[model samples]
Target: MDSILFIEIESSYKAIPLLVFKRDHHSSIIKKSHVRIYSDAHALLMAIEEQVQEFQKLIEQQTIQMIEDKERELNEHISHLQASAIHQLTLSQQQWFEKAEEQLNKLLDAQEKRLSEAIADARNSMASAIRNRLIKMNQSDSLIGYLSDALHAELNDVEKSLVIVKSYSDNGTTLTIENDDCMVSINTQELLSELKSCLENISDD
Candidate 1:
């Protein structure tokens, strides 16, 4: 039988040992035991470091995913806002154009009405002026004929002896009678005036 030594590690609050090891009487194996303990401790530390690195990679990946999601959300929001603004602008422009067109139509209608009225007034004025001119022309022709008949009646016997001359001026019409002895002048306007007064008196009677 080989001589063996037993060692136990325990906490102060527990009666059972947390760890147990068996040692043999080979003095040279004790050094190998120390080496084994160091190797196991180093392996555990390596595993723990690897686990920490994996955890760090996981945290970095989660952060990157969160950042990407936030950027996507922000981009979508901006796009929505731009679309809404464009729609609103289009509606506003349409309304403005419609209003402007309506106003322009109204202005055109009013201008057309005014032009028509002005044209009617001008035509009426021209017609009245032409009618008055025709009446005046008729009256002047009648007056000239009456004057010629009176002159002929008065100088019936001396028609060949008398040289009669007629002149027109802005003030009135004039008649000149010339003979070997003297010349006579008569204003046709005064004769016409006296004739008009005689006609008026006869009408009143």
Candidate 2:
């Protein structure tokens, strides 16, 4: 017999499926044996997660490089504009300004799209990992804490530029591990490390 348990996070939360098995049976013995298998699965998941994070970081780095190139082009255009501004403010200067503005806008849009896609990919992977942890711990009473530790380990290996973006209610907070030069006060990486340590301690308890 297959038993399913559905757990909901909240009213807006989707229910997750977990298996149930009766204790003191042969199947229960097999369940205990499966601990080793789950450990193996955990290792495999971590490897896969590392590869995925590497790929994401590569993409992000490439995107940043492309942005830097675009910024150089924009700077050149601005310089040309400034030079033209010194002249009689001709129609040709207006045309150049319009074209430069259009290109800048396009580049900005593309950069934003790339960032959004990368974040979405990370979120999906994280959610899948959480689901797998829950499924593996179906019969265990203390699953959340264990899963939290696993996530912390995973996060430790991720790039400083990428952090998990989660939504509370309808608002979203992007917890970036990278330091932004624009905002010196937000030391997100340190904050995340402390948070992970707390979660791991909870898991140990």
Top candidate by TM-score? 1
List, residue by residue over 43-153, the lDDT tens digit for candidate 1: 898999999999999999999999999999999999999999999999999999999999999999999999987876676565556545543643386666666666655
After the best TM-score superposition of candidate 1, give how far the Cα of residue 53 lies from its true spot, in angstroms: 2.3
Instruction: Give the per-residue lDDT of model 2 (tens digit) for 1-205.
Output: 9995443334421231123323455432324334445557668989999999999999999999999999999999999989888775677788899999999999999999999888777766665565555445443424333433444455563333434332222221222222333221222234344555554454444
Instruction: Look at candidate 2 and give me any clashing residue pairs.
Output: none
Q: Highest lDDT: which candidate? A: 1
Error of 1 at 170 (Å): 30
In model 1, which residue pairs have backbone atoms overlapping below 3 Å?
none
**TM-score against truth, every candidate:** 0.43, 0.29
Q: Where in model 2 is the C-alpha error above 4 Å?
A: 1-27, 31-33, 89-205
* Model 1 collision count: 0
